[model samples]
Target chain A: MKGYLGIDVGSVSTNLVFLDEEGRVREAIYLRTRGQPINALQEGLRQLAGRLPENTGILGVGATGSGRFLAGIIAGADVVKNEITSHAVAASTLVPGVQTILEIGGQDSKIIILRNGVVTDFAMNTVCAAGTGSFLDQQAARLNIPIEEFGQLALQSTAPVRIAGRCAVFAESDMIHKQQMGYSLPDILAGLCEALVRNYLNNVGKGKEILPPVVFQGGVAANAGMRRAFEQALGWKVYVPPHYDVMGAVGAALLAREKMAGGGSTRFRGFGVADTNFKAGGFTCENCPNLCEVVEITCEGEAVARWGDRCGRWSGSLGYQDEEIRNAV
Target chain B: MKVTFPHMGHMWICLSAMLEYLGVNVVVPPPTSKRTLTLGARHAPEFACLPLKLNLGNFMEAAEQGADTILMAGGCGPCRFGYYAQVEHAILEDLGYNYRLVVLEPPRKHIGELLSKIKYITGHNSWREVIKGIYFGYQKARMVDDLEKQAHFLRPREVQRGSTDRAFKRALQEVIAARDPQDLPKVREKVRRIMGAVAVKPRPVLRVGIVGEIFTLLEPFVNYDLERKLGYLGVETDRSIYLSEWINDHLFLGLVRGQRSRKEACRAAAPYLNHFVGGHGQETVGSAVIYARQGYDGVIQLLPFTCMPEIVAHSVLPGISNELGIPVLSITVDEQSGEAGLVTRLEAFVDLLARRKGVVVQ
Candidate 1:
């Protein structure tokens, strides 16, 4: 009944994945973050605990995402790794011998080039939110259609309009202008998908050799229209693994599995932690001219972690909560 | 005249000590921060490079502190750095700072011209005193460089996390507070011992060379303390560009007595890049090849967003990487590169290098 848990808390969503001992996913939960990760995590954990079988044992937990440090502290994870590692790990595992990984998540998109199961190069979009899932969501809302339906609508387009995709602002205006120019919604939606994929290839995937056996994951990969565009853009078979949306969480679980030897126990705080009260607070440290804002998290009324200090004045002073024995120690 | 200049890493520490020693009143802008970047970005042309914006910000801050003169360095290049001084001067004048911008341009035209420019700061000091002041600055720069080098080597392997950083910071303070130039070498020796004395486990790890534009590579604020992030991930880092090395190569080449090595680096870079695109672009490629051939694990190219030279370097790096069989990661940062994203990429890079070698990162 023992299983490993992995959590990924990104700006747009929180994903929780449970894996059996054989490294196969048993359960996956993806929920909106809504700008508050703690609530989403707690709620996600609660739902997960409720769904588990009686006497089910959770062995190890791993966390990854933009909120990984905070998520790891809260989840009491055995390993805390970045989204890039998690995504790369998950993609490589899904498609053995994956040469490239294209992940376009809620807020950011990244290109990971791998060789022989090791990540060799990566690039994230710079300072512009042009080709990400959230932008897709925004466009869907403006188009007055459910985001889930938007991608399918793109598939119906007879001739997709060409929308400028260099910048997000430009893309939106172009989409509106196309809508006014009598282009069908499906055509416009398909055009938007193509624009985003083009943007991804030009910027994030720039200079990276797009070798075959490419695996595309992340929240955006759920959009079949985007997947088709990628296949055309790269002229290679783009494999969107079965669990496209929750790859980061799955990868984290796999990493946790690797970290745990047969006898090594996990740092998992147990499913009961879902009921525990966790509060986070922050204050700017005025001791120096840098004025660093140091944030601390309290679990059951005890300061467990501190971060965001330029010097170790704050983070070093506070006691960490069951920090990973070997990760970033 | 009370003098001030833009800050680049710890350049101010050495420059302040040297200028004060030469009897010129010095005004240092507040150490660069979010405020400085904001002020610079607000005032700078949107298309200008990050360093220019930062310098403008520093100059504005220094001017507010009643510094009447801007002592700046000048460059001539296909890169935009050489144009920084002139544009910044115009901006400050338009803002009515009433400051004299004294540029210490490179002596590509005449060595005497450079001498005359430096002579203004020499004042009533004897020629011996001027030489003494220059030597003193050189010693401090060399010491800082050596101490930093030692810390980089030790930090990844240090038994105590942040031990080398604390010791190095303490040593730098001693250097900054040093009243006599003669006290520099002793400080250097003492600090080197302290940093080198850090207890280390000496585990073999991936070695990464940071190759890119000079400003972004040296200034921790701009690159978000990249070296430390790599070090804590258990990776050893060596920078292709150092402020002291740049100074030695370009400004005081004769004093340091290095001519062959400069040509050697260019030659190393020549195979992949054949010609200099501008700034450190050639060095970035050359250093990667050098690191790859030397059997290093990988190279990370850090550049400011929209940096022309580094953009050229980025395009050429993968080809070199493919040819040499060493991996390269190019990280471009602007004002908005969040800490989480940068750290994630760095960790993933370290992970990649370690895994490729069949080494598990602890």
Candidate 2:
């Protein structure tokens, strides 16, 4: 079997997916980033390698999400794209006429408005990570409930309480207050989901003409409570694709397929990279007043990538110029 | 008296050159950096906009370098910036920096005050020499702005990455080192030739108009070098305001030919914003409309956090964007803005533009 590999190393979770030659997801691996993207990616790749059948031929690789540049260099991605493009592509591909895509990941939430299979407008949360998957996870942990069961609890609510959701810290305090007021756990959870949906609509989805065929993806889509809240608020049937959590990976794999459609070889570093010893370190460049903190990634004690310098001195030293990254995107 | 001023993109070059021509000792603040922002944010009011914080940082750094006199521009308007000079001075005095602030207020309403401030800074220079120095500085400002504008034009088309920035930096040095006013025209011609010779690939480039508060539009540090970033993303940018344009609009230099009149912008913005809400609010709306009508791909608005006028402008931007069928991305920057977040939005915005225009094959 021949397939394309897609890796999405986001803030909260790193997801890996393998798309067969026909673009069907053959294998998917999801792992917690745990504040270490490299380790999470390696673990994911290891799991994916074990899951794939013997003699599986990897044709291409793609990377997305915030840690895309890091993932690209490590995975040797043939296509590197931003999360918005990746999500939109995946949503549209799966749900042919997906007009609206609501993606709430760990640290970011975005709304992509598409028309006639092309993206028209989009918006991402600005400097605020409130009402995202991570916030939900924190609330679920505080309530002593597993994140997977948080949504099911919300569905049992008979009377949903209103919780403030403008800011995450305030929202937590509001939830605690509601709990103190003796509101049922289900009601409070449902209300929290509704509040998050309201905030998402007012902020990220502000001024966006969200018509029918709304698709909600990202890790947050796994929450039935959020899905219900979105339906109640938007009054539209929201579709969650089968692989909502790994949609970014799916989109990346699709893009990789398109990039390699012209019949060119991919830059896949091979699955052996999972076992390769890699080290990441950073140093503050004091050569100038700016004092840029440059990060370097090494494989087998040899530096492979360097970045984060403003003047491109240290970053350019490794010959992994941004021009190549930009071209890939 | 060692004179010092805040950095606004390349305005430092123009100001330092003008002061040097007037036979005044000048202390240029070091280029804005993370330390500058940290120092500024620590001393400045928590709610003050990014520009004010940066100005405070510039003063503190300049004071440490033995600068005893600070040159700051003053204005009278609805914008909070009119009181920035006073607030910055108070903050510096509280920080124990015994620096004298010579604020040149708008010449229209404070002609006597402006002249005295200039006279104090210029010392024994005759009125003729002062006027000549001012004109010389104005020339340099125009040349510098022209070079920057040319660089923006060349950045998206340059065959070699970073070549346009390289030429721009070298050209700025030549403009700064220029001593004689007569040599400015020669430098201007040379700059044109240098920018023209940057080896362009002749590829069609997306044009983006930048509109927002003047400080954010002029200062690269506050907005994170937005123009350079967009240029590198294969988009050409035309900003609403430049230092030279601001100088022309506010100073007696309005008589300078070729300087765009604020009246035109006000006229263009009349439909969306009839009156000046201050701090380039009307101009922001007008520039967006102008860019859209000019067949530009999109408009980006840069606003400093807590800026009153720009917040109003931002609210009105969506209407214009929808009516005009152009995409507008309003980015707010404060002390906490991360570069990664900005880049992601920019890349997504560029991707949207590319898809809309059918430029991206995939």
Q: lDDT values of the candidates?
A: 0.84, 0.90
TM-score, model 2, chain B versus true chain B: 0.97
Model 2, B73-140: lDDT tens digits are: 88787898888988999998887889898888888998998899889999999999999998888889
| TM-score for candidate 1 | 0.96
> Per-residue lDDT of A1-329 in model 2, one digit per residue for the tens?
99999999999999999999899988888899999999999999888888888799889898999999899988889998888999999999889998999999999999999999988889999867889998999999999999999999999999899999999999999999989989999999999999999999999998899998999999999999999999999999999999999999999999999889978898888889999988889999998878999999898999888888888788767665566676677
lDDT of 1 by residue, B202-264 (tens): 687779999999889988889889888788788889988766777777777645764224456
For candidate 2 chain A, the 10 contiguous residues with the lowest summed lDDT are A318-327
Chain B alone vs. reference chain B, TM-score for every model: 0.96, 0.97
User: In model 2, which residue pairs have backbone atoms overlapping below 3 Å?
Assistant: none
DockQ of each: 0.60, 0.63
CA shift of A211, model 1, Å: 2.9
- Which residue runs of candidate 2 sit more than 4 Å off their true CA positions? none
